[model samples]
Target: MRFATAEIDGAEVCGVIEEPFFHPFEDGVDLLEVLRSGELVAAGKRAVSRAGMPLDSVRLRAPLRPPTIRDFVAFEEHVEGVARAVSGTGVAPEWYAAPTFYFTNPYAIAGPFDEVARPPGCRVLDFELEVAAVVGRGGHDLGPERAPEHIAGYTILNDWSARDLQSAEMKVGLGPAKGKDFASTLGPSLVTADELEPYRDADGFLRLEMRVAVNGEVIGRDLLSNMGWPFEDLLAYASRGAEVRPGDVLGSGTCGNGGCLAELWGRPDRADPPALEPGDEVEMTVEGIGTLRNRVVEGAELPPVRPATARPRDRER
Candidate 1:
């Protein structure tokens, strides 16, 4: 069943979708709690039995406020392109050994149709097209074989990026920090994992078609089956020394090559899309789960931090 958390007439509402409409839960209901009950399908059916609100009527929001977000680089081709563009090298050997991920600020999430502002002093803006899994069941030290059950649903994720800041921070070797924490977009709706089972293969890969567009022009496309590591492995690895609780998100990084402009940089084979600007709209769609869209908006100016003064080692001694 498809579920959504949105605003209706200025109040928050969580609902189950029945195509053009969505059946609202009570005035106040927690989405994760509903998923954990293991009765989402039944409740959804019951909700659909009642008259519901039109999907176009309400404003969409991030499906849930995730407790943590682990975004993994799971596609080899994507990394091959990005690494070459940024560092003049091919995919790193270590990437093949295991699934690696970075944590982004979950609290900074934006809604499907929300406007994302270019961060202060940021001119090189980018967006990543990804699929994120929402944990329904909690677990620690989960094995890859046991991770599938933990996924409550799937949603389209846009890990909004500020390339200029990201590049500078990575050079310092610690963070994507202020570059990434600014905003990440999720939603349209949460699709229960069962809905995607038909696309899963014997190798456990999902053969869904993923595509992205900038202002209605399709710019990149790839198959979800191309990922080097699956969500199961990502979740398993994420749970290694920590607990993965309900509402935690695990992202299937940028799909194939061309998933983002950073990946296409200097690639003669692919046409470079213009940098994202205020008023530009980015839309990412994965077959089975619907499209997630966001608009770019001008950023608010921020006060600058004072730079540190250089110190001489001899003087300090």
Candidate 2:
């Protein structure tokens, strides 16, 4: 089932996507509520038999606002490419020892077709193509073998980035904070895990084609099979000493090779493509899931960054 959230009659509701139409749940519940109730699959099935509206008639939102977002660096090629580009090095040894992730702002999530604003003072806006698993059942200290059961569905994720700010801040050993908190996109639909059963391999990894394009021109392409660490491993690792709750989202980071300009810039054979500018349209597609398209727009006036000034100390007489 392809689950989605859409705005209709000035209200946001959850629905099941059926190609040219969307079948909203009869109970008028939203996706987040459905997930928290542990009734996503059943609710989706019930929605299918009801009348649906034309897909073009309504506005779409992020499938649901996640409770928390944990984005993991699961692809070695992406790590190596980024390291070489930014620091002139290969993958860090620590990366291989365990799956590493960072918490990103969940409140800033955007839906498919939403307009993303170029962060203020940002010149090099970039996109990281990824896949994310939405948690279904809450768990703590889950083993790798059991983590898969907790995943409710999957969606395409674009980790919008401000590369220049990210570069400056990381040098201070702190954040990707402001550089990333501005906007991140997800959706078109949330595809249930069962829907992807056909693509699952013996290792429990999905073998799916993933690609990204800007203004109709393909820029990056990869297979989901290329991920160095599986989602189950990442989830299990995430659950250590913490709870993975319903509506929590876990990202597969960027795919291998050149998923973003930062990675492309590092590759010897590839020329850096122009960074995202206002009016640029980005479309990311994953097999079994769906295409998520968004446009970049100039943002409104942002708060000014104040200069740091030391306070004058009282003169000691």
Candidate 3:
């Protein structure tokens, strides 16, 4: 079953996406409420059989405002390519030891069809093609074998990036902060895990096709099976020594081969696409999930950088 959060007649509600139409939950119900209720799949089906409106009549929002967002770098190819592009190095040995991830701002998420502002001073705005798992059940120190039970569903994720800002900060040894905090997109709909059971391989990896296109031009394509580490492994690592709550989101970072401009720029044989500019539209699609679309627009002007003040002690000396 697929679920979505939408606004209809000035009211926001969670609903079951029945193609062509949306079957909304009772008045005042939202996706987060449904997720925390732990009855999404069954409730969604019940809602679908009741009254609903045409899907085109409502505005979509990020499926839900995740309580926490943990995005992992689990694709070796993406890591290798990005490392080469930014620092002229190969994948760090440490990356293979364990899955690593960063907690991004959950408040800054955007919905499908929303217009995202190209961060001020950003020259190389890029998009990461990813798939995210939304946690349904909360847990701590979950083992890899049990982690799958906590996953509620899947959705397409676009970790929009400000490359210039990211480059400058990481050189100082601790960031990806302001550069990434600006915005991350998720949505179109949340597809329940059971719906994807058909695609699971013998090794338990989903063999789904993933693609990203910018303004009608196909820029990246990859298969979900290309991920070096599976979602269960990433989730298990994330739950270690910490609690993963309902509504927590775990992203399967950028996919392998060519999923973003940073990777494309590193490849000598492929011509890189121009950096994202105002009015650019980005669409990311995952096989069992759906397409998440966003338009880039100019952002508010940034404050001027302040100059450092002179030290009084040095002047006196």
Top lDDT model:
2
Q: What is the per-residue lDDT of model 1 for residues 244-291, given as tens digits with 9 covering 90 to 100?
A: 888889999998757898888847575378779999999999999888
**CA lDDT, every model vs. true structure:** 0.86, 0.90, 0.89
Model 2, backbone clash pairs (residues 3+ apart or across chains), number: 0
Q: Highest TM-score: which candidate?
A: 3
Backbone atom clashes (below 3 Å) for every candidate: 0, 0, 0
Model 3 global lDDT (CA atoms, 0 to 1): 0.89
Residue lDDT tens for model 2, 152-220: 989999999999989988887986888898998989788988898899888778899999999999899
**Predicted candidate 3 versus true structure: per-residue lDDT over 176-207, tens digit per residue:** 88889999898989998999989988888889
Ranking by TM-score: 3, 2, 1
What TM-score, to 2 decimals, does candidate 3 have?
0.95
Where in model 1 is the C-alpha error above 4 Å?
36-39, 269-271, 311-317
Error of 3 at 196 (Å): 0.7
Per-prediction CA RMSD (Å): 2.0, 2.1, 2.1
TM-score of each: 0.94, 0.95, 0.95
Where is model 2 more than 4 Å wrong at Cα?
311-317
